[model samples]
Target: MFTRNGVWAIISKDKIKDFFHRFKSFHIIVFFVIFAVGVLPCFILSRGIVANYESRAIEQRIVNIKTQCEIIINQMGMSEYLDEPSSEVINAQLTQLANFYDGRIMVIDKDYNIVKDTFSMNTGKTIVSEEVINCFKGIENSRYDKVNNYIEQAVCIEHSVTKKIIGVMLISVSTDSIVDSIDILMTKAYILQLALSLAIVVVAFYVSRRLSRPFAKISDDIAEMSEGFLNEEISVKSYREMELIVKSINKMINRMKVLDNSRQEFVSNVSHELKTPITSMKVLADSLLMQEEAPVELYKEFMTDIVEEIDRESKIIEDLLSLVKMDKTSQNLNIMPVNLNELLELILKRLQPIAAKRNIELLFESFRPVTAEIDDVKITLVISNLVENAIKYNVDNGWVHVSLNADHKFFYVTVEDSGIGIPKKSQEYIFERFYRVDKSHSREIGGTGLGLAITRNAVLLHRGTIKVSSEENKGTTFTVRIPLSYIAS
Candidate 1:
C-alpha cells in the first residue's frame, strides 16, 4: 500500500544510515567543513548583498522624491500659491507627483496651516507635528517605515527673492516597489544557495568516499587474510599512511603464516616422537608377555628396556610442556640480580658428571667478576642446555671450555667443545623446534631436539642474544651476551 515516493524515502534513509555507519568519521568532517565554509558563508553573503541593495534603493528613492519636492516648491513660490492657497497649477503638480509615487503630498504655510493637500483630505487644517515645526526653523527631516513600506520627507520652502522660509512641504511615498524588488532578489538568492548546497553535499560525499576507500580496501584484505587467503601483500598505495599500514599488516600476516607452519610441523613431530617410544615399549612388552616362563635375567633386561622407552617418552612430553610454559612466560620474567660467574659455575658443576662419563674435560674461566639482572631459573636452563649439549657431543678425552667476560653494559659467556659439529646450513635451523641434523644420531644420543629451541626462547625473554659457530669435524662454540641490567618494556 506504499506510494513510490514513500518507498524511495525509506530506501534513501536506510542508505544514509548505512553510509554513516561505514564512513562516519570522514563523512561527518567533510559535511561540517562544507557547510561551515561553503553553504553557511554563501547564505550570509547573500543576505548582506540584499541588505546593501535595499539600502541603496531606499536612498535613491528618497533623493528622487526630495528633488520632486524642491521643484514643486519653486513653482508654488513663484506663482504665489502658498499665500493664496487656491492655485490650480501648483495643486495639480502636487497631485500628479503624489499619484505617480503612490503617496500623498502636503504644503503648509508659516503659521502651520495646510495650504494644499494632494489628497484634499487635510486642507484648511492646522498641523502641529514636530517635523513640520522643525521644518519652519529651517531644518529638513526624513523618516522611513520599513514595516509599513513608506518614507516621509519634510522640507522648507523659501521665498525665491528673499531666501526666507515661506512654507513646509511634506511628501510621504510608498516603498512597496523597492521592497518587492528586494524580496524578488532574496528569493533568487535562496534558490541559488539551495542549488549550491546540493552541489556541496555531492562534493563532500565524493571527498569522503575517496578518503575512506584505502581503509576499506585494507579491511577487505585483512578479512581475506583471516580466511586463509593471504598469498600476496596488500597493495593499497593511495596515501603514504595507508602504504605504511599495508606494509605492517603484510609483515604481520607473513609472521602469522610462519608461526602456523611451525605449529603444524611441531605437532606432527610430537606425534612421531611420542609414537616411536610407545611402539618400542609395546614391542618390549609383547616380547616378555609371549615368554610365559622367561628367565629372571631376561625378564629384568626386557623390563629395563621398557623403562628406558618410558623415560624417553616422558622426556619428550616434559620438553613439550616446558616449551609451552616458556611461550606463556614471555612477558612475566621473574628478574633478579645474580652473579653471572657463580651461575655459570653452578651449571658446569651439575653438568660435570655427564661430561666426565664421556671423558670430556669441563673447564671454566672467568675473565672478570660479572653481576647482571636476569631470571635465575630460565638463565640456568639456557646455560645448562648449551653446556650439556657440548659435553654430550664431545669425543672421548676431548675438552669443553666455559668462559665468562664482562664490559660496561653487557656480559658474555662462551661454551666451546671438541665435538662433532653441526653443518653450516643446519646451524641456521638448529633453534627451530624438533629439527635435527642427523635423526639417527640424535636418537642414539637421546636428544629431544627441543633443547636449543628452549634455550633460544629463554635467552630472548631476558633480552639477550646467542650465536653459534661450528665446523663439520672441528668443534662448535656458542657465545651468549646478556645486558647487565634488566629494563622492562
Candidate 2:
C-alpha cells in the first residue's frame, strides 16, 4: 500500500544503507579524511590566486596606458597639434604610443570633429559617443570590456591658460598579453593541483592501510577463536586503543575457556552421579536373585534399599530439572509485588518442623514492613532453601535467625545460623551445582547440592546480589539484596 514517493524513499534508503555496509572500513574512512584535509585548500587557493592575478594585471596595465594618454593630451594643449592637424612631433608621439600598446587613439576637437586618428581610418570623421560626449563635458571616463579584451579611456583636453575644455582624447588599449599570461598561469596551477592530489592519494592509501593492518590481523584471530580455538590469545599491541581492545577480548576469552571447562566437568559429574545409584540398585538385585529361598524380612529390607536408591536418583533428576529451569528464566518470570515480611515468615513456619527435629530454633524478625517486585514462586524457593540449609547444617539447640529490612531502593534478607560453617577454601565454590564442602556429611544429610546454585541464579534473575561470610565450626551468614522495582533484561 505504499505511495510512489514512499516506495522511492525506501529504495533510496536501502541503496544508501547497502553502500555504507559495503564500504564501511577504517581504511576507506581514513583515506577520504586525509585527502580532504590535504587537497581541498590547495585547490581553492590555486583558483583564487589565478583569478586575482588576472584582475590585478588588467587593472595595472590600464592605469599605465591612461597615464600615457594624459601626458600626451597635456602636450597637445601646449602645442598646435589640434589646430595644424599635422604637427610632426605630436603625430609621432601619438603613433609611437599606439604602436607601443598595440591599440588605437582618436583625437576629437570641439564640435565633434575628429582631428587625428592613430589608425588613420577615422581621420577628420565626426565621432559622437558616450565616452567622447562625457569627456567634452569635463568628466574623464575609463572602462574594461573583458569580452573584447580591451581597456577604453576618455580624457578631456584643456587650454593651459584658459583651463577650458578644448578637445577629447579617446584611447582603446588591448589587454591580450595579460589574458595570455593568465591562460599560462591557469595551466600551471591546474598541473600543480593535479600533482598535489596524486601525492595526497598515495600518502592516504599508505597511512590508512598501515593503521588498519593490526585490526585485520585481530579480526582473523577472532574468527579462528570462534571455531573452538578459545585457548589462544589475541596479541595485537600496535596502538594504545588496540592494546585496550586486546586486553578486553583476552579477558573474555579466559572467561569463555573457564565456562567450557565447567560445562565438561558438569557433564562428567552428571554421568557419574546418575550411574552410581543404578549400580547400587543392580548390586542389591543381584544379591537377592542369587538366594534360592530368601526370607520375607530380608527381601523387604533389600527392596527398601532399592526404593531408597530410586528415590535418590529421582531427587537428583528433580534438582537437575530445577537447575535447568533456573538457567532459562529470561521469559518465564511471573513478577509481582510481594511482601517480603510475610514471605519470610511463611518459609520459617514451613521449615520449623524440620528444625524442631534437629532440636534447632527457627526465628524470624522484620526491621520494617518490606515489599518488592519479584517472582513470588522463585523468591519463595530462594528463601526456603536458605532457611532449610541453615537448619540442616546447624548444631543441635542452635538458633537460626532470619531478618528482613528495606531501604528506599531495595530490600535485604539476612540468614544467620550457628552451623558447621564452610571452610575459607570452599566458600567461593559453594554456589556451584553439585559442589559440597564436606561430601560425606552432605550425603548423610541427603543434600543434592543444587539449593545454593538455584538460590544464586534466582537472585541474579531479579538483578540482586547474594554474599556469604562464614568461619568454620563457628557460624555462617548469608545476605541477599534485591531492588524494590523489577528491571527486566
Query: Evaluated with TM-score, which candidate comes out highest?
Result: 1
Clashing pairs in 2: none
TM-scores across all candidates?
A: 0.83, 0.81
Q: How far in Å is the alpha carbon of 88 misplaced in model 1?
A: 1.3
Report the C-alpha lDDT of model 2 over 116-139, residue by residue, as the tens digit.
999999887899999999988878
lDDT values, one for every candidate? 0.88, 0.89
* lDDT over C-alpha atoms for residue 396 of model 2: 93
Q: Which one is best on lDDT?
A: 2
* Candidate 1 per-residue lDDT over residues 255-337, each given as its tens digit: 98799998898888999988999999899889888988989999899889889888999988988888899999888898989
Which stretch of 10 consecutive residues in model 2 shows the poorest summed lDDT?
224-233
lDDT of 1 at 207: 79
lDDT of 1 at 246: 84
Could you tell me which 10 consecutive residues in candidate 1 have the lowest summed lDDT? 22-31
Off by over 4 Å in 2: 1-13, 20-24, 67-71, 137-139, 214-218, 228-230, 238-264, 286-299, 330-376, 395-418, 459-467, 477-489
